[model samples]
Target: MLAWAGCLGYAAYYSGLDAVAGISAGAVAGNGVHGAVGWLFSTGDELGRAGVYALTLAALSAGSVLLRRHGVRELPGAVVVLGACWLFLDSHIFWPRGVFTMLAFAVGFGLLTVAASRWSGRLTNP
Candidate 1:
């Protein structure tokens, strides 16, 4: 739980402001359908994008805390999905931080899997 919170909190605080700009810049650099749309529509341009990122960060943080408190097993899967989304979205944007964040989330997923396997009788031990 602390790990999840820490990961999300760090991402939210560090990347929150830059995420939108990074995404836009990355999109322009990546040059794809999403990038084109972002460029054309100016979705999340500057402060707007930052706001969205902040809100998303808050949501993720809250979700992580809630999942941990409730002992929900789906938290790991959620983290993986969120990480994948960040990876894909940021890949389009060309942000290095996005790549780093993706890596963090991937590692978290791996850790979660290992932990689950350790606890569950269904897992075969080598």
Candidate 2:
């Protein structure tokens, strides 16, 4: 959950619109570079933007580490909140390869959930 939140947060902050565009392009034209470049070049104020991005990444990494140690169920609300923020923050932006990123995240999360569920069941059932 924390990892997902971090990824989502990073996606939102870096290239939401470009992500969407990238996804669309990949779906229609089979390419993401155009959309990705769009966002990459859009970063006009590098120093300030980098600072903000760095802070956000730090927070996300810290949150993920803390949450992992504590357990996902112990802070379900926080997980949901972070996930929502990530989704909303990225929804407005488009990027090249954005669709692929979303798909990757979804698949990764799905696999993680399934694996965790199986592990939990094994621990309880055994």
Top TM-score prediction, candidate number: 1
Writing each residue's lDDT as its tens digit, candidate 1 over 24-95 gives 556766765554645533543444444435535654665565466545664775576466545544343346
List model 2 lDDT by residue over 10-49, tens digit each.
Answer: 5564454344444444454445456555444344223224
TM-score of each: 0.34, 0.31
> In candidate 1, residue 66 scores what lDDT?
45
Q: Candidate 1: where are CA atoms >4 Å away? A: 1-41, 44-95, 122-126
